[model samples]
Target: MEERLQKIIARSGLASRRKAEDMIREGRVSVNSETVRELGFKADIGRDEIRVDGKLICAEETKIYVALNKPRGYVTTLSDPQKRPTVISLLPELGARLFPVGRLDYDSEGLLLMTNDGHFAQQIQHPRFRVSKTYRVKISGRLTGAEFRRLQNGLDLEDGTFVPDAAMIDEINPKSSWLILNISEGRNRVIRRAFEKLGHPVLRLIRTAIADLQLGNLGEGDYRFLKGWEIRQLMSPRRQNERLGKPWEKT
Candidate 1:
């Protein structure tokens, strides 16, 4: 299928559509070895020999989608300036410069989507996507029913505030409480902060699901590519609406 040059560049994960247009206008993009600065320039992605600043970019190879059952102690960044172990290091065999779609803090673990598909990545991270991400969290102490209700309502924290789309105690042990938390907001440390504001500290956090997608039996530090149908479902507007529902709807 043919697409605008900038669209292809955005899909390549180099930049967003707007940024790609800037690159094109700067005479950085070319088609068939000829510089193309026209904003409306189009090309058949599979047939065109496109280059960005003299480097060929394969549009077909631009998209890569993988899900990782992230283990603790790995940062969800491409490469840290501090040289911390990064998520991309785990996918050495993937042979593509993919990035984590959203993020999972070093101490948190579970289903994290990695991709080179810029538009897809942007869609997932965009607040408008409203994708529900589910996490299994183990907190240090048990909370009363009222305390749990407070979390569902929303909590104000020192750093910020947060509210889980859905939060419940799935399993209760003597010393630890296991909770299932679904959140639409991708704020940093949201789940942890919500519980902290309620005076409960999280000991462990594991992302178990994203929308209809589940981590399933994926082991720690293990990953698998998203199947074609799975990708389609995640991108479909209908499915997104179904997963997110309308604003103010209860989780």
Candidate 2:
């Protein structure tokens, strides 16, 4: 069956549908020997030589989904023009061109979903799917009860407002604090700014979970492939749509 070009790239795990669209627009994606920029273009994955930046994508024997406990300082992109270290640099054995589903900022690290299945990444990362993302954040200062409540409600940032799916203080120390923040929207550097607005600066932000999947015991910079059941859960529409409905759902 024919699928959208973005979908093809996404299913190959090169990136999410939206990011694949960006890659298309940037002339990094091509069909056979021609550059493709239209977002809705389609092709048969088995028959076409779909390439991204001149490298042909090989369809996987089985789509691979991975949960990476990323350590701080790696960029989430497949490759960076600046030659900065990236998430893909950490997994030279993945074989297929999988991509990080959403992203973790260069300095922020935690549970990062890596997959070769673009549609799965799309469903999980797309705002409409309402994927749940949980973060364990360490802040530079103490948070007031009112400030914590404001986070629970939502906070306006330089980009936009962020309404956390759930927000609460997980633990507190005299100099540092830990809070669990769950949100659906994958806004850039959202968690950092949410506390910044309330006079609490984020020191370290690590994602603890994504949807029903937890980061659990995965050491920093370590990763593992997704199991069959986990993949089925991700592909299931009923649960996915249910998670996506709540505006505050975790990403």
Candidate 3:
């Protein structure tokens, strides 16, 4: 079947459509050994030889959904230029190339989603879904009364003020404090940065849940295929709606 080159790249999970176009414009993409810089180029997936950055890409048609209990040391990206260990290393048995739905900071641990379905990935990660993420955090010192009040109201970071959807001091040790927070946005290092801005440097951070999905007893460094209902609940109406819109389901 013929498709836009950008669509092909995006579907392969190598980059989003916009980024794919940029890759083409930069002469980073080649079809059949010829560098293609035109945005309107189309290629037949069954016959054309397509390569991104000199690496041949086999476009994935089968969608696979997976969840992993990410440990603290692994970065969430597929590959890092620094040669750091990534979450992809944890799923060595995975046959399909899966991309992380959203990133977890290298030092933070917990529930993470990986998949090959672009639409599902966009749906969950896009801000439109308003998916809530829960994190349990430990900070280096007990929260001062003013800091606690400020956190409860909102903490002003230089970049932005984060008013957590829910914030609670779970416990206070003499030297440290344990707290939990729920937030709908995926701002970079928001929890840690927010705490630091409030004068309590974060010692540990772990995401325990995403929306209603819990990490549960899934041991660290383990992954499992999402069940059908789990997929439906997370992906929601997008996948099913598309299938019903297309006639291939009847065939």
lDDT of 3 by residue, 1-251 (tens): 98889999998899999999999999999999999999999998779999999888786767788889999889999889999899989987667889999989989898999998989888888876777788889999878666777886887777778887776777888899888787878788888888888778898898888766778999999988888888877766443211111111100
Once fitted onto the true fold, the runs of candidate 3 whose alpha carbons sit more than 4 angstroms away are 1-60, 237-251
TM-score of each: 0.73, 0.71, 0.70
Q: Write the per-residue lDDT of candidate 1 for residues 64-108, one digit (tens) a residue.
A: 899999999999997888888998888866667888899999999
Model 1 root-mean-square deviation: 8.1
What lDDT does model 1 reach? 0.82
Top candidate on TM-score is 1
lDDT of 3: 0.82
- Residue 176, model 2: lDDT of 76
Poorest 10 consecutive residues by lDDT, candidate 3: 242-251
